[model samples]
Target: MIACPRTLFWIVLLVAACFLAGTTSGAASVPAPADGPGLTVVMDNNYPPFSFRDANGELVGISVDLWRLWEQQTGENVQITGLEWDDAIRRMEAGEFDVIDTVFYSEERGEIYDFTAPYTDVDAVIFFDADLPGISGLDSLDGFVVGANRGDSTVKELQEKGITVRKYPSYEAVVSAAKAGEIVVFILDKPGGVYYLHREGIQDRFHYSAPVIRGQLHRAVKKGDAALVTKIDEGFASIPKAAYDDLDRKWYGTPVAEPADLRLITFFAIVAVLIILLLVVLNHTLKQSVAMKTEELKQELDHRRRADEALNRATQKLGFLNAITFNDLQNAVFSLSGFLELEKSLPADEKTLAYRQKQAEILHQITAMLRFAKNYEDLGMKPPVWQNVSQTFLIAISHLDMAGLRRTITLDNLEIYADPLLERVFLTLAKNVLLHGKTATEISLSCKRTQEGLVLVFEDNGAGIPLAMKEKIFERRFEGKKGLGLFLAREILSITGITLTESGTEGQGARFVMLVPEGAYRFTDNS
Candidate 1:
């Protein structure tokens, strides 16, 4: 049978009220127990779906609902205390709370608290600014600045795996920072990300990458609270599957994952034992068979060794090819820039200058394509080298046919650490506008430093993308036949820890905003 936690809380409150009323009548002048042993649950009030503040600023959510059920079924008072996420975690670790709600279990965390059977499945997702390209998976996030909620297991897991994690105080802060372009990627639980996107009204702008980090969400209690853990597990088991499903639907708009059945484990164990017995019986009759199997294993090991060698060689070759391609593109852009400069000096003839300008633009396109390809490949394998932001901008502009297009580029020239390869990111975007921005006669580029990091703007006077296409454009190969110019641009920018997103869809033309994190420009000693 399922016990509704919310209903139980109300029932308890009602009973307490009646008890106080009857006691006031001087029936028995006795005091209630002060501090008897009971369950203490710590929960964060700001986490929606899991837990959050209601209109009255009271803590409420699925966890709150479940705890009420525990109280009602056991007829015991489980004191629920609200605290901030960080404070709650610390208190739980210190054994101040007998139970902590909505914890994701990990091997490291298991050392601190005993975990209940998993009740939910969570997958980690990457959140970026609306204009940024969608990340395909963890590989796409290599070398990108990713934000995570501080004290979260997600942060711990990422850091432990050698992925850089920027810690924020709250999920709201993480989203705000990501939207403001302080971080290129924000890693979060899928459900949490969805809830946050809807709450922040940015659902149309941001998306989750297809690949996810899968994990189990389980309840946790103090390490020594074996009895409480067992009781909670029992409570969970007693709940009807339908009731659990309904609660999941209410919170996440999806059915909850069914608990894993132990039948498969039992079956596998039985199969393994039979196989072992068969092997033992055969061993006595076939001594020669063991030698033949050993030879086969040796051959298999040799083949694997060769495959590993081949893979290493392939990786090295790819890296070399990328480096060579980048250098070639750089030289080609320099040559084009020089030619354009010479065209301006020679003649004022309109037709001749126009031809030269067109040639320069074409060259610029080729240069951008090569650079974009190189950067895209590099992001998956190497960390970007930190360089001056101004330098990156200049490299990007070098690929622009500025003399022919007659566009002005302005900047505050603020110095910050940035990836040199990010030059391709801007070049590709500028080229995209020149090629497709039909209504645009002018393009403007500029940058500004904010309290957190930097914001780069690329605006064009061309007719903006249709309202419907604005969000879809960042999708990988979204236009089907269209090449991956914009997608590649987004990928490269992400590598340098910048998120590219579209802004002001209702305005005259398209405006792309790139939020660059401070980490993107940090200078290392070698640099």
Candidate 2:
């Protein structure tokens, strides 16, 4: 509740001198029974709805009406005086009034006044211009200039949070500054602020957050005035609950419905019906569109299925023909070998013998080329798979003579996405090491991770490749070699975007690095 006593005080003087009129002539005036004890009440006159001067130049509000009823219940002469909040507090402490209504209790005030039980709760909130972003409470007012009444408790609250605030004399002045575009952020009691905003037709220009501080409104008497406290509480308690509800309704409830309200209600009902109808039509149209699209997709899937079956049939036929051709060619080469062997036994001149030897060498190269082609025929025939690197390397070395060779594999349980012929790649590298790695004793396979990818390495303690031939070695034309092993290894790896490169010291060893791009490799275990 925004009703902090000392901090909320604000001066709004009435020039008409109508301050004492309510005590003598308004509904608050009560005939004094002879010798009856009396109580004088004071509160902020400028606080709207709770206490304020009406346009008729007379002080009237919930507080005023409440005290009038209190007089009837207690049979005591009650004097209700309205002044600026600060002035009311000053005069009450000066002993000019017996009670001050609409006050918030605080520790400092506890030493000066004895407060009655709280009668109502009010909320204090942060009100900001609608255009101001992120202004929810005191904490959010850091960069913006905030406005508050000169003595408002909210001002101190803002200041404590390290926010700067511009002080005004009263809430009225604060609202005026907002309307003038002088201040875009301010704090005020919600009810009074809302009432003023509506009256001025500026409610749309500002937005308010939920209560930043909730305070209970109470009436207070001089310290040590226990008798007066009891009288005030008892008088209020004696009033019927319905009476309090009526006052709340009069001040805060929905306005009384008029004849024009029925027409407004009718217009809103028609708009709501139209909106519902529009939604129903839109829903029906969307369902029809979805159904049409679903049918089109089903037809597309069926067409692809038929095309895939045809492709598979053609591939199987081609594979069978290729197998037959390869078997016939191998048989022809074997027969030629027998003929050459017989010819060797028949002595010939040196020149003729040299030509025969040359022919045999060409036959051997041709055989090696045919074997390579057979092996590569299935490359990329199937989708790439996640092969366990360590296991695959072991399988590759199994086909080689390893009587004296030692192998070290630190690839862990790493898996890489590559052509099924991935194992063939490792086999080719191992074979190269055995054939070309002069003086090599050990071969090792390992992997290291880099930003671009995982580098799968194969190295052997051998006469390593020369710097000039590192890349050229992967080319099929290298050394005019008939075996396409290295060249095909690169093709197999490239199927899944992996690259093979050699990066070994010339005299130290041979190192083959296969870079498995990111997303193509991962470890299966904690190695």
Candidate 3:
């Protein structure tokens, strides 16, 4: 009996060793010659429309279609692996995958990966709470805590400006934080944010700011994958616009019809048929009716063209005016900076110098507001560049002369992509604190990222905005005869696709919060 058991164990060990050898041989054999250059592409299976898993657990979307075309054209044997976005990115960075599909190229990304020519364009926007004031541009987010996705381009941009940025790992975390009042603002790519908001049934709870930051979506390849990138570029160039349009219609449910050919042959065919009928009286009547109809159509078209031109001119004029005003404000601030420097050199009369320095600081705040306004005007222009939130904040704070404010501003490493107009929103709120919260000695500003978007918080221990004024604050020309700073702040923020609102009450001081919608930030060649 002992001998029989020992023999059985040896037999089982022999089978296991054979199986291991076969597995090793399979892995070492390499892909067949006909399989072409074996390459593995990584992508996020959770991102819909671009790349995602279907109901049957199949990886599919526009990126998949494009990848198939690439394989066909280049004879590259490609395998796809679906993973989480962060995991895919990390793996690609680690050189574990040959490529990552559907990423937006930015300055920060340029350091990490080689990007192909863009295949799609998108925007980053700001989304605010339902009770928030309407935001028309970037200027409306002043003093609001903004939330953004961690490791996103928008976080860098927000940090560039003086605005506070909070970072979160995922979109869901951002939404939860916003709902919990942990952050006031969120920013994200437009479609992704909208999809998430709708999916979470929070569409009615938040609003997006306008004048979106445009970003171009592209495929990312491992650095030094020049051959692959060139092949992709060539393939993209070869694909007909019609084919792309058709694919778009298929996925997005939008019909795209080709224009009918209007060749001479077609016109002559109709003419010949009419003449062959030989109905002279009918032809004359028809010609008269057609002429009248054409004339009317031409008249309407001319009127519409004129109207469009007039509207464009008016918009241009308004933009120019805003720019000029912004410049004036900047000049005033610059002058104040110089005066403050001069005051340092003058004989020190402690109290008088202090008062003068305070005055200069106040002027500095006004300049910040002006800079924000200028940014708003610039963002309104066609082909606006991505505004760096971090840079803007640095500029705003650099002018503040911290020695004078008696308040500390704490900011986390958060970035956001928004139009420069958002700076004005921050400036406006800060200016309000200086003007109205005179008794308040301490003000706090913070920013962090949330999964849903970016959230910003601004709080001051001063006389807060009255309840009566809260509703009216965002209205244009409100705030009792003052320049439409708050109103324009709201309007400017709206233009960037974000919303701003007041939270907390008078006795509790004031808290301003802003949310950036998903898809609000994007990468674009036009910058």
Each prediction's total of clashing residue pairs, residues at least 3 apart in sequence or on different chains, is 9, 6, 121
Flag regions of model 1 displaced more than 4 Å.
1-37, 239-527
TM-score of 3: 0.41
Alpha-carbon RMSD, each predicted model: 20.4, 29.1, 19.9
Cα RMSD of predicted structure 2: 29.1
Q: Return the TM-score for candidate 2, rounded to 2 decimals.
A: 0.45
Candidate models: Cα lDDT each:
0.63, 0.73, 0.62
**How many residue-pair clashes does candidate 3 contain?**
121
Q: Which parts of model 3 are misplaced by more than 4 Å?
A: 1-37, 53-58, 134-139, 176-182, 240-243, 255-527
**C-alpha lDDT of candidate 2 relative to the true structure:** 0.73
Tens digit per residue, CA lDDT, model 3, 420-491? 556666677777777777667666777656897777777788888788778677664412446467766665
Clashes in model 1: which pairs?
5-69, 47-51, 131-500, 131-501, 131-502, 132-500, 417-521, 418-521, 440-462
| Model number with the top lDDT | 2
TM-score of every candidate relative to the true structure? 0.45, 0.45, 0.41
Please, what are the lDDT tens digits per residue for candidate 1 over residues 403-497?
A: 22435455543444333446676677777777777667777777777876778788887777778777667764412335466666665565445
lDDT of 2 by residue, 1-527 (tens): 12222212121112111333343244434344454457778888767667887767677767777787787787888767887776777788899988888888777689899999987777898887664556666677676667786655566678889876788766677888777656667888876776666656688878999889888788999999899899888988898777776655444433345447766987999999999999998979876998889989985775455345434643664476478657856776776676677667777877557757766765775666567667767875665667788767755664465435666668767998777888899989999988889889888889899998999899999999999888778776523563368888987787677889899998899999888888778787553
Give the per-residue Cα lDDT of candidate 2 at 433. Answer: 89
